[model samples]
Target: MTKIQPSAPLRSPHGSLLRRKAKDNPTLASILGSYEKFSTAALSLVVSDKNSVFALVEAFNAYRNEAVYLFESGKNVPQENLRSTMLEELFSWLFKDLFAILQFDQPTNYWAGKATSSYLTLTFAPKNFQSLFEDPNPKISKKDQDFAIGATVAIKVMASKSDDSAPALTVILPVVAIECKTYLAKNHLDMCSATAQSLKRANPYCMYLIATEFLKMDSEVTPEVTDISEIFILCKAENAERKKRQSEGKPPHPMHADVVWELFSMVMGHLRAVWWDPASSLDRGKVIGRPF
Candidate 1:
């Protein structure tokens, strides 16, 4: 994939919860540990880049069998809640590793569409991308453009019908779209013209831009709109000492907290937060909706 280097120094906000770095570290053991909590009946299919996918498959299978055995002996009977638990654990672990090397500090928000199960789809839209004005050109649908922005990483075990039924594209964990634009363009005429040439989708006429990070709509995007109460900014955390004090007291200033909270708040409303610690072989625990 050709890397589209940022034109400017995409400012990295502070205090954003980020993915942990463990690409080279021992993630196999972590997978194994998570696996040891399911039954043999449980099916798992991992489709990923060839480089690391095989080892991951093997490690998981071994862990699954061990987990089944452990449950059979009545030691740690696979939690009946294996699916949700495992999903949260794996996601947290992976994101943690990714966090360590990520450029931004925004706490990655996880959300699920109306789809059943823990499966989700991530959508990313850069605020400045010219694609904002482009129409969804039915010609370039989601499937054709799956990798156009970023790839969807989903677990394939949730779709199992029977013991023999192969696990197809089961649950879509998240469809993370990168460099997405939410607001209207500064130059409507220029944006409209550019949209004609761009192969991206435009915001639905009814949709409104939810500002985050440093993306503030100027008069160009919304001329008459002056103040928006619901919309909030996603910023970094500074003055930790003052925040600590404020928390202890009532009415903490919003600016003191990390921008991660904004994303977290948005996600918490729609999806559950699953905590996973990639650094340890332990389950960070799953909270079905909301953190703190």
Candidate 2:
């Protein structure tokens, strides 16, 4: 009998086009400016403030352990509740304290937490992109509109508006959107991918992410889900549980520290790009334009 050889992996026809497009993506370029500098600043904060890092890790572990306990105890606790609670606490740690370490002047009026609104409406229309549109009069299509579905966490920057006839009032746009999952299953991944794609269509620059406590899905990045900038797995399942499973051994998961650091750096980078003013050099001592 002749030995059979494994077939080569299939490739998408538009792979080159996609790569080229991503390379030319101005939004991506601007957001990821000076990666080394941003990462160094982010790392220094973690290394300098051991207490904050410890607190964040403790909070994350506690959240996961609580969920596990609730599930194992046969309680009817909804996974959504656990996920929401965890993300809320995590974001508080990130935006309130950790991110401030990177900035020269503390940011004021920045909000990061669960979104109260049903749907995030875009103020401006996409001119160059065809995937998303600005619906001047957005109507509710389904029980949950496509735009609002699966939007668990939001980060907003406050803006002031003034008119000749009215006093100035504060308003905000959903600058960053996140989808959280207790365990990222196939269905959850699909849902998040769809949501991210829709958000990108509407606003190409919107920072979109899918975060999960446990990574229960394949490690491969779905080519179709190009809009999702990152997929973060916060923690791994209990080692004992994994070991008990005879067939599947240890699953692929990132370390807690790495995940936290990466997430923090990404968040800080976005904040710097969007909220920080270069001219004033508010929190940043000096203005350094993007080198590349």
Reference-based lDDT, each prediction: 0.28, 0.45
lDDT of 2: 0.45
Give the runs in model 1 whose Cα sits over 4 Å from its true position: 1-140, 143-212, 220-232, 236-258, 273-292
Top candidate when judged by TM-score against the true structure: 2
Each prediction's total of clashing residue pairs, residues at least 3 apart in sequence or on different chains, is 22, 4
Tens-place lDDT digits, model 2, residues 104-173: 5433544445544523343543334542332222232111221111223333322223223333223333
Clashes counted in candidate 1 amount to 22
Worst 10 residues of 1 by lDDT: 12-21
Candidate 2 ranges beyond 4 A from true positions: 1-51, 62-67, 75-80, 102-109, 118-172, 219-225, 237-255, 274-292
